[model samples]
Target chain A: MSSEDLETPKEKGSTGEKQASEAPKPVLSSGSFLLVDYTIRIKETGELVDTTSEKEAREAGIYDASKLYKPRLAIIGKGMLLKAIEDELVTMSVGESKTFEISPEKAFGQRDPTKVKVYPIRKFKDVEAPLVVGARVNINGKEGIIRSIGSGRVQVDFNPYLAGKTLVCNVTIKKIITDDKEKVQQILHNRLPDVDIQKFTIELAPPEVVITLPEEAYLLPNLQIAKRLIAKEIQENIQGIERVKVIELYTKQT
Target chain B: MSSEDLETPKEKGSTGEKQASEAPKPVLSSGSFLLVDYTIRIKETGELVDTTSEKEAREAGIYDASKLYKPRLAIIGKGMLLKAIEDELVTMSVGESKTFEISPEKAFGQRDPTKVKVYPIRKFKDVEAPLVVGARVNINGKEGIIRSIGSGRVQVDFNPYLAGKTLVCNVTIKKIITDDKEKVQQILHNRLPDVDIQKFTIELAPPEVVITLPEEAYLLPNLQIAKRLIAKEIQENIQGIERVKVIELYTKQT
Candidate 1:
């Protein structure tokens, strides 16, 4: 379905279609940015999963007023947005705000029953009370939260993302970020510090580009095989790169 | 922190120790059941994350009268419970309900920054307006629900399970199923039909029984992979099975 068709009951406007059509095609320049404030409600149940207030932003370390107040920015052609929502953003201009609904296919996928399982009651040594059904517990040594508790059986369901759930997220476009590969990389690296981008060196070999990484990265247990994996990722993600070479170098750091 | 010290402001009664000492431990046996209905809340924020409402239980396909009204159940050992909470359940008896506080370490554990990342705005095509700071957005196919948006930058942090926040869960001991392994598996599989118990064959290797799966199970795609993963999980979870043999049987059709 079209993006406009996904609006919630509260999102309807008299001239929404006209305004969207007449609105200037936002120019996503190199440094232009926008800031917006919005809340999220589940489309099916309208339950609020979460929302951010100005107070929360300040507490979260966002100090810059300009960036914090009107911080919605957009970048076109660059994958700087959610494909589902970005499709909507491209249809609006500055100062335009709209609430949209996304299906489970677009948001978080549907819940997977396979991801849920029953465990022996003994695993809950730390609990002092009796076990019951519908009790939510924490999975030991894993990034999972239990959804239910049963008889001599304890059911632990991994996050569908861990098990793969098609989620439907209703969101508002507050603003968009600009398109700056370096800035984006810095943001990504800053957010994911465990990922050693320094290990991978990128070089422009004209039409064909080559990337190299330290062999130690591969040897590191649980490391996400970056060089080859990233090479394939970059190729699939970016156009004009004819080929990518992943070279592994032996390092004596260990 | 001690359980008493961990009690947040919302805790209803005296600390867990005080309540445990006052209530007589109900004599629980096979068939002796308890019914409890409670809500799990975040102690610090007093936010309700999960609840065992009759409405929700009915919606989840649990139609038994006991499950609908007062589901009396027993608490077994570890695998059936969270180590921290299960440790607490052992001290309680039937018909008793308590609201206890669990530290983040015991609840959801510490938040890992490695899971956070900031992606380019271009990835969100349907989003028209700029991303606002603190607006929730989906990131890299994960529900980050946006934390912050900035120039050429969208700072999307993920920690849905609030890190370091104390959790308050109200538990009622309903009926505890028998501790028999086969019986437990039947209950779990019955509750969650997607879990394949047959795929996971139990091997009677004394003191260290093993559970094996057919080789074809692994070759199945994402959904099937998820199913097999759940099956293999049964082996690692069974209480008495110290050693598990995950054999890949080529003859079996998964």
Candidate 2:
């Protein structure tokens, strides 16, 4: 029985309310780093929005070779794994899996009809004639799908493709990350998804971190920017670090 | 003035040869870093080739704002600062200047008649019709100046423009960089000419040189490649350096 139910029983409280007051619920700690494998689908069209499983992605014909398919690390209160879903996970434990529905109100929000508009065909300078009706376009940095092109007028729908959709999320809580070093490595992996973070040697001296990058990381595209970003994320998230030294030692090639 | 004349003169030696061997000719030390201002002209046509002075470049109508025009650093033995010029500089001391002639053999090699070739106009995929003769063209990684274009044929001269001509060189020795730290910074300035090298901070511990890059260097074009190149240059040339740490520290802006 709940402490509030037992201690402060209202004189006019219904018997049904008193009967359902069983036990205090278990809640997962906020900011707990969780490793989760998840798949999100739009409830109405059954369209696959995202999946961490390579097999699932391939089956749905949504696989991208450039993307790394792996379990995502979601901090409990960070809201990266859908806020409503994270709220649901707060009451669940590791080793448990759940499938739940999120309404449009909590998901991408209802589609606004005003976002659909018409423009002159000349406005799309890059689009060729005999245009595909469903082709996607970027008009002034806003992504939209073409609805129709008739008589020199082109109709465009600028609402987010996922708007107004109810999401069916299937998620499994694999484990909670507790080690500080592993957390930093996971952060690095998130930034440099292509490179193997395990090869990098990270020495954490309190108030300083020395990250020795692997040889493969030397000429990777945007590697310098990524290194700076990795350092920034590590310093901001991982406490007690005043400096991050990302060192890349170039050995003589024979 | 000949030391050899006063000391040991062979009985068979010519008087002219003995008179020229005056006072054991003083030579500049090899590998000495020197700042030299020079102007080069083709002796035949008197066409200006190169000059270190900005005013001279402007007067010649070939001034490019992209280039940094100042006294150039010439390491005595390094082939970069013209071998013939270095040989001449060795005979002349500081506070002295000399005007000398370099033949085609010692300067750019004599222009070969076989190097000039006629090609079909179609070979130049990027050239437009009614092309400007004497315009520079790069064909198959080799640079050439166009001589004529007509009847589906274009005549290209691939010889170095300065080839086959004797060069009249007017030069002055400005200063020799002596400080070891300034030498490193000067090397850096040679690599990154647009940014001021004085703003960068360098900490030298034997076998390890730490270079703190300025904020202006953070987003330069090919900055990552440039940083790696800088580290490689410092390690290769600088003495007692086993490691080069080019550190760029980013601070949060308020």
Q: Write the per-residue lDDT of candidate 1 for residues B210-249, one digit (tens) a residue.
A: 4344333333334223433433443444445433333322
DockQ of every candidate structure: 0.01, 0.17
Runs in model 2 with CA error above 4 Å?
A1-32, A75-82, A89-93, A117-130, A138-142, A147-155, B1-32, B76-78, B90-96, B114-130, B137-143, B148-155, B173-180
Clashing pairs in 2: none
Number of the top-ranking candidate, with lDDT as the measure: 2
RMSD of 1: 30.9
Docking class of 2: incorrect
Weakest 10 consecutive residues, lDDT, candidate 1 chain B? B245-254
For candidate 1, the lDDT comes to: 0.47
Q: Write candidate 1's Cα lDDT for A18-42 as tens digits.
A: 5577643345333333333454445
